[model samples]
Every structure is written in structure tokens, then in C-alpha cells.
Target: MGRKAKYSYEFKLRCVKQVLNHHQTVEAVSELNGCHHTTLHDWIRFYEKYGKKALLPRKNKVYSLPFKIKVLEAIEEDSLSFSQACLKFNIPTKSVIMNWQKTYKKSGIKGLNNKSRGKPKSMQFKRAKKKSSKPLTREEELLLENESLRAELDLLKKLQALIQEEQSKKRKP
Candidate 1:
């Protein structure tokens, strides 16, 4: 639901060119273009490293865990850099390969699995909230009774305080 910032490849190219060809300061160029200097810096880096092709837009691709593992293995075996992998695989961006590398390291093959996005609508199916109508176990009953006693004790404390205040007022009078 949040607004996503989208920039055309041409705009990025122009920004990169301005920095590269015109000798314009990255900070000044980015400020004039209404984009951050770091964004411009990244664009320049990508342009310099991978050329304009790196800035081109591509459709989203969902990679399977097997494919992810394979790519990770290739990267490890070949000692390929993230940029090299992106170049060799024709990946839209280097970040995809970097993310895969991170996932591979953190969770091996399992991390590549696509997790379900967004909050669940219902808690009934959730593992934690599985209350039943069955009679409570002894320990559970004791805990329940202890909670009940604590609530009563709290109420008694408030009443005791009120009684003590009343007695104190009468004694003062």
C-alpha cells in the first residue's frame, strides 16, 4: 500500500552521464535531480561496472530453491563475484545474487523458499492460540486459579486502601 519510488532507466543513464561526462559533482547532480547522492553513486557504480545494460528494467523472476542452491554452488566453486554472477546469469541486478548469497549462508537451501507474505487474517489456525473446551490439566488449573486469586487480591488491596483512608480521616476529625 506504500508508494514505491520508480525511476526510468533513461533518467538513471542521464544522471550517470552527467557525473561521468560533464564532471558534475554527484551530490550536486543528485540534489538537482531530486534523488539521493548514494542512489546516484550506486547508479554510477553499476554503470561503470556493468554499463547501461545493468540499468535496464526486467520483469520479476521467482527462482526455485534448487536453482538458488545451484547458483550458490556455482558462485562458490567458480569463486565468482556478485557482479560476475549477475553478468554471467544476465540477472537484472546484482542485489538478487547478493541476497541469494546471504540466504544461502544463513539458512543453506531452506532460506531460498518463498515465505508467505503479509499478516494472517485469522489466529485460529496459528499454533500458539489452540484453546479447547476440554477440562484443564492440574498444573493449568492451578495456574488459572492462581491468576483468579491474584485478581481478587488486587481488588482486596484497593478496598483495604480505601478502608485505611476512611479510618485515617475519622481519626483526624
Candidate 2:
């Protein structure tokens, strides 16, 4: 699911109308609405270029590598500003294009490839048990038994220490 917008479409349209139709200045409208002037200006521009649809919340789009390259090329070839590039390409925000430019500069075309978000499938909290067809030797079995015994001893020691601490605290107060 897409994230909810900070400003509703109606709110943006009202702000934009205050600036465009009411002859109010962008800074004045934005200041009154408690949003940045630049943000209000972008809204005005988007409204002008794409109408009310531009004010609606947009779904997160996964741009293909080729499409990213194309957008980057257009930005470079046309010397378009981030805002202009976003408006031209119908991208949701200028920061998205800015990040693309930074990634392209830092890692080249390979960086433009879409990466999976969130934890990878390979990550696991609990390790999988090893499976082997061969039986364990006597020495290996003895080593495993010793390890388990040591772990149990450590856990018992901790529990004993915690109990003693509680008893001492109770005696103190």
C-alpha cells in the first residue's frame, strides 16, 4: 500500500487556488498554510501543468533502469532543472531525480537499477541446523555434550546470581 500524503489533495488545491486565483503570493499562502514557499510553488506549477490530478497522492513507482537513464539523459541534454525534469517526466518529487543524479554520478548506470527494499530473504534470526548423512564420531559426540553442559552451567549460574540479588534487595529494604 502507498503511504498517505502529508497534505490532502483538497488542501493543496485550496492553497494553489489562493495563490493563482486569489492573486495571493506563494510565500503568503504558504506561510498562512504553515508550509514552505518552495513547496507551495511546486504545487502551483504542478497544478498549472497537470491540473488537479497532480495534487492527488501518487503511488510509489518503480522506474526501470532504461527509463532512469532516459530521464537522466534528458536532464543533462536539455539542462532541465530538477523541478522541470520532474514536471516533464511526471515524477512525484524533485528529490527522487536528485537521488538518481547522485546515484548515477557515484555508481554510474548500475546504481540506477531498482533494488529490493526491506530485509533480504537470506537473513534469518535463527540459524538453520546442519544436516549430515554421516554419523558423528565418539569424540565429536563428547565435544557436543561438553558444550551443552557448559551452556547449562552458565545459565544456572546466571539464575543463581539473579536470585541472590533479589534476596539481597529484599533484605536491604
Candidate 3:
């Protein structure tokens, strides 16, 4: 397995202090900490230059759909290509352009707007699954009753046919 990433804020400060204040060489601190000399040098530079922002973890920067649409509009207005847009906006990828173009072509403005774009959480489905569902309409109940009566009548006709067949056989014998 790869070695875990080491990120000790206090340790970074100590290393930076040793390099800056004690006249310790980056190579010496690197050797003592089991890190690369270049890595130690970079840390020292980062501490000296950016202070704390260089050490703090960066949050994921997400652009909303509307924001993305605006970006695309700006790219179109500037007549910039995908690569140019990526460079101009400092975006990490080209898929952003492709996706925005697709949405713009499909929906004009509304497609780019934020909306719940999938099957809604089914309140109707939940109601249907309840132990006591809403009562059927009178027409629906009447139709069901008619169907049951029809089935009972058909069963009675079959019993009558069987009885007639048995009687006819007895008469023949």
C-alpha cells in the first residue's frame, strides 16, 4: 500500500521555523523528517508566501446550472472555443462546455434553469400502498358488482348443464 499523506499543521510550522530561524538547510530538515528536500523547500516557500491558505484544504467549487449557462453565454459572446473557455474561466474540464451546449440546444433557457428533472416523489404511489385506500367511486363499485354477478350466473349455467347431462345418461341406461 502507498504511504498515507502527512499533513500536520504544527509540524509544517515547526519545519518552516527550523528552516527560517535556525539556519537549518532544507536538506537537513528533509532528512530528519523522512521527506524530500524539494518538498521541504516547497513547504517553506508556501509558508512564507501564502501563509495559511496554502496549507488549508480547498473546498470543491461547484457552478450551478444557471451559472453554467451564464458561463456558456460569455464564451459564445467572446467567440471562444472549448479549450479557450476552459483557460479563460479556469475550469477543470471541457465536459462543462459540452453539457451546457446540450442543455442550451434542448431547452433554450428553461433547460439551463434548476428544476427537478426526474419522476417526482410519488405521493399518489404512497397513497395507493396504504392499508386503507380511498374508497372507489360508485360507478367503479357498481361495475365490480356487475362482474361478480356475471361470474356467478356463468357458474350456475355450468352446473345446470352438468345436471342435464347426468339425467340424460341415466335415461339412456
Give Cα-based local distance difference scores for all models: 0.81, 0.91, 0.72
User: Cα deviation in Å at residue 94, candidate 1?
Assistant: 3.4
Q: Give the local distance difference test score of model 3.
A: 0.72
Give the best candidate by TM-score.
2
Cα RMSD (Å) between model 3 and the true structure? 16.4
What are the per-model C-alpha RMSD values against the true structure? 10.1, 5.1, 16.4
Report clash pairs, candidate 3: none
Please report how far candidate 1 places residue 74 from its true position, in Å.
2.4
Better of 1 and 2 by TM-score: 2
TM-score of each: 0.46, 0.70, 0.34
Q: What's the lDDT for residue 136 in model 3?
A: 84
Local error of candidate 3 at residue 108 (angstroms): 1.0
Best-performing candidate as measured by lDDT: 2
What is the C-alpha lDDT profile of model 2 across 1-173, one tens digit per residue? 67888999899999999988999998889989999998998898889999999999888889999989999999999999998998898887999999999999999998989998977788558886796899999999999899999999999999999999999999998
Better of 2 and 3 by lDDT: 2
Q: After superposition, how far is residue 134 of candidate 2 from its true place, in Å?
A: 14
What residue pairs clash in candidate 2, if any at all?
A: none
